[model samples]
Target chain A: MLNTLFSGDFPRSRWLTGLLLLIAVALLLAPFLFPGSRPLDTAAKVCIFIVLVASYDLLLGYTGVVSFAHTVFFGMGAYGAAIALAKVGPGWGALLTGGALGVLSAMVLALLIALFSLRVRAIFFAMVTLAVASAFAILVSQLFHITGGEDGLSYSLPRELTPAFRLVQDKVFDVRIDGRLLTYYLVLTACAGLFLGLLRLVNSPFGRVLQAIRENEFRAEALGYRTVLYRTLASCIAAGVAALAGVMMAVWARYTGPETTLSMDIMVNILLMVVIGGMGTLYGAVVGATLFVLAQNYLQTLMAGLSSAVSGVPVLPNLFAPDRWLLWLGVLFILSVYFFPTGLVGRLRGTGSGR
Target chain B: MSGSFESLLARLRGGDGARRSGLLLIVALMLLALAGVGSLPTWITLTLAGLAMGMMVFIMASGLTLVFGLMDVLNFGHGAFISLGAFVGVSVMAALGPWMESASLAVNLAAVLAGAIIGMVVTGLFGYVFERLVVMPVYGNHLKQILITMGGLIVVEQLIYVVWGPDAIPIPRPETLKGALTFGDVVLEKYRLLAVAVGLVIFATMTAVLTRTKIGLLVRAGVENSEMVESLGYPVTRLFIAVFIAGSALAGLGGVMWGLYEEVITAHMGMSVMVMVFIVVIIGGLGSVEGCFLGALLVGLMNNYVAYLAPKMALGSSILLMVVILMWRPEGLLPVAKGR
Candidate 1:
């Protein structure tokens, strides 16, 4: 049953399995164990990002394609849900329809980009996607009537998912069983389910083909797999999953904007997570998202402490400033690319070289 | 001997027929824009603006194409050098504020020259270090190259923020280079004219060196087949380093020019301009200098004309141009000796 649950692809290492279990347990009881809005928000972000980063892994890790437009699909989904909710009101129908619209739009855009560029060299795809994604972002901001421009859109969810909605009259374990908790649980459940779905997809025969393409595209093509078709399909799947993640984010935050879902910084963060966690492994997304989101949320506070501590030193305080976190992350990203290449999951699994 | 020289020239030109066609495309685009606007003055003004923008883009893109042509390394971090150049140049000019603000043309020119020279030198040195530290480790691997360079870009951008305090620095044009030259209601910015002149000089000088000089021959030959050039006793590694530094210096010069043109410099400017550079390189074809030049001009003109005629389509015009060009010629307008 356990084997079937994991799609017969185990973590393959005891430490990895243990870490995964620990994360799972901590996440499952996050509200009860860590009773705070900030922690809950961070946890929710991690849950959402796991799916986002994992979907990216499907492209970069599995298919050997580095697309800068992952955020475009993500934005489409977020905007789709946000627009739908704003227009149709905050009911389940509006939410689901918006999410579906977002996913479908993302899939179509991904399909178009894939069909158009994947036929060329891999590098061309990267450049083209960057151009297209930036253009899309500018277009979104310009179309203020629909997208709310830079300020973004904010709307409430269904009453059952709002903070005002009370699930239980009294506090449970010193925590109000309100719609916030309900929304958090909903996001967690959806993320886990989506994550498993990605795992199952990757472990399947189709996924093996993607891995084969990543390992050697020419070899895969020579073996009669029709490389472009497979790559395009993989991109579509990744796009769909990414959009779903975007929808989840919209539902949680009750706000969607270019800065949140479509910014280059978010794109860079996604790349960092995928690389630092481990490319080509679904678990890498889980581990990377958790660690990165945690760092993102708390690293500034930690840096603030360090900055103040080193106030007497020249340059040290500036280097340790709260906003300078990306510098360290950037340094770590380069080191990971150079030293590990397979990320922490790969390191834990002893697959140091990735291949 | 003269026949051999002519053949060498021909070889350097790469594709004479394709080159003419690319130039014709530029002319055709201008004519098309003229037809759309119908006013000669507006068209000329737009054309001049487009040419100036094209030239600046070309200055920045030239180094990137040369680097890619000679060494199949796509340095995504090339933008860091641009940002660094802008910051350094602006700082130098800022320091020489009195000279920059002087009414005397010589003093104003001198200040600007100091900024340009120092900016180039600083970026040149930075490129050398960047080549050694960030780029040297990941050679011949496109995937790692992109990822690592992107990592370098992020780090350098963050460093710029740390150093410059994450604020946009605004710059005023040098006294002599400000304002416009009007030809009977056909007005042109003085700085834009200078940009065009500088771009042409660089292009002409590059052309002369590539066709007439031994080093240029070697660089061209190396682009075609580095191993052959290496076997022929030329240190390809040294050539690669030289090209990399020169390319970086040119990018710096472009950065200074761009910063002056925009009248503002931000840490993120490099990355933003990088998208345009990438588009230019792709449209010009990777590893092709002439192609890059033509591509930049085409994009510049397209952007200017579109922005004038249909404001809404301005953002998408260059991208749309890129898509159309790719469909027409997958290898770009003028692919180099061995297209990547």
Candidate 2:
């Protein structure tokens, strides 16, 4: 299995494979290496988002459908799991039931949308999805009985994943790897596995047909490919994967909310991740998610420091105000889209990088 | 020059017949209002409220459709113009505090108009710069347009924070504009009536200009075929830029109206209202102004009616309507004759 994974042009080239392996190893050992709660949490966030963005990439990068409803499926997965646990209490059975339900619901919604909207103009489809996604978020928030309204749903996670449990009494590398460490590893491994699975899926003939459809719908249709069915299938798969990402997020946080999951903000963040990481490249999600999560967490602090550093002269020192961090991020996002359409992963991989 | 301008303005105000979709929408709204509302006074109240809401929405959304029709530019940053216009209006009101405090309706109205004019001028200038810097390079590519313009919106939103602080500013309605006029307990807001009137004026002007005048001819022609228009020796790019400026101005004007309607201004106000604006645009058909007007009315009426009936579902009303409309007519209610 390992030889086939390594040998069958599975991950672009040996250099990329080495880099991906290194990143995976680092993520697996993040808790021990970082030895801090904040860093571990951030890394975990990066992991969850990697799964989310990679799932998004399947639709956006592979199938070429710009769906605003991606976050709705994500939110559904989180809420589904959270609500399930809240009702039945925490156990493997509850988790499995919730995960299955979430995946099932996401696929259902995706199919409905694909069937209804797949034949429309691309922009029209995007607009319809935006409207649907926004309505879904609003509905979730308003259904206070089920979704806990704006406060969102929180419930007990599986005991092994909770922070109360400790696997070791002593510290390794001056870090306490508690049950939270176990959770972090779970997220890391799950994300890595999902990423690799996506890699294999995208490299398959199905993905090639989707790409051909994206490049030229008319030509793809002329070739006797039922583009709509292929797109719908791709959307359903993406929705399921995104829901799994949502399950991971809910498990990691032990909570789910409209603000955190269902909002357009998350949808926009996912889009940014894919675009900046390089759309079309499965590995791009990993890099984009990491880059975004880290930047979002610390960019403001860095800006504050820079502003204070320039306080003596006070010449545009407010350029890096924490509140204005988005301004800079927006500028950077635009510049990247204009200059680095291939993204960091694509650049590193070099010419004609699977665009 | 002044006589010509007046004639042009007159042509704009001339009544034009509604298209098939527009007429159908009006009939549906009337029928639904009658069916759901029951009482005459309640129906009137709801209709007036919906009318006013629809008008405010139309002012904001008209710019988006015009721009899209003219340029095929998906300007996600359009919200920035709206918010800026609102903030500018607030500042104008603040500066002309004495006038705003006046009980004289004429004085108060003039002050509000002054603020609107200032907002429009400033937003138009900003729109020019925004177009040049953010939208020019990424023309013709929808994907890039969405990404870049979204980035532009973020930058502008943050800039608003830097300028206005991260607090929601209270927008005080002018003294004369406050309160209501009641006819046998059928209370109608003074500002809302004014908003409806303003909306009509704008709509008439837009219709007149689009249908009757030389520039209107160019715009309509350009909307149908910009390449052909360009081939006809007219600078279509220049026409597109002018439309952008006008659209931004309208957004600013609408923002001022919405700010007064809400009695508040925040950096994210434009973003919040954008949901409604985008919905209205989609429901109206991507490039049709008349469609936007009809769509806004439907959405506004549905929102008010549903809020009265089931408040929880009120938020989702417009979206539900759009879904239904799209189910029936996949393109939109009143799709333009442009090649999709």
Every model's TM-score: 0.97, 0.93
Q: Tens-digit lDDT track for model 2 on A1-355?
A: 9744522434554556676777677777887777778888888998899889998998888777888899999988888898899888999799889988998999999998887778766777676777788789878877888889999888988888788887888877787757888888888888878877877777778888988987888899999999999999999999999999999988988889988899877887898899888888888887788889999999889999988887876445656677677778778889989999878777767743443
On TM-score, the leading prediction is 1
Clash counts per candidate, in order, are 0, 1
Summarize candidate 1's per-residue lDDT along A1-355 as a digit string, tens digits. 8777789878888788888999999899999999999989988999999999999999999888999999999999899999999988989999899899999989999998887678766888888998988999999999999999999999988999988999889998999999999999999999999998998999999999999999988899999999899999999999999999999999999999999999999999999999999998999998999999999988999999999999998888888999999999999999999999989999989943344
Give the share of true interchain contacts found in each model.
Answer: 0.70, 0.63
lDDT, candidate 2, B108-188, per-residue tens: 999999999999999999999999998999999887888788888888888887777789999889998899888995888
Candidate 1 second chain TM = 0.96
* Quality class of the docking in candidate 1, CAPRI style: medium
Show model 2 residue runs off by greater than 4 Å.
A1-19, A166-177, A312-317, A351-355, B1-18
Cα misplacement distance, residue B17 of candidate 2 (Å): 12
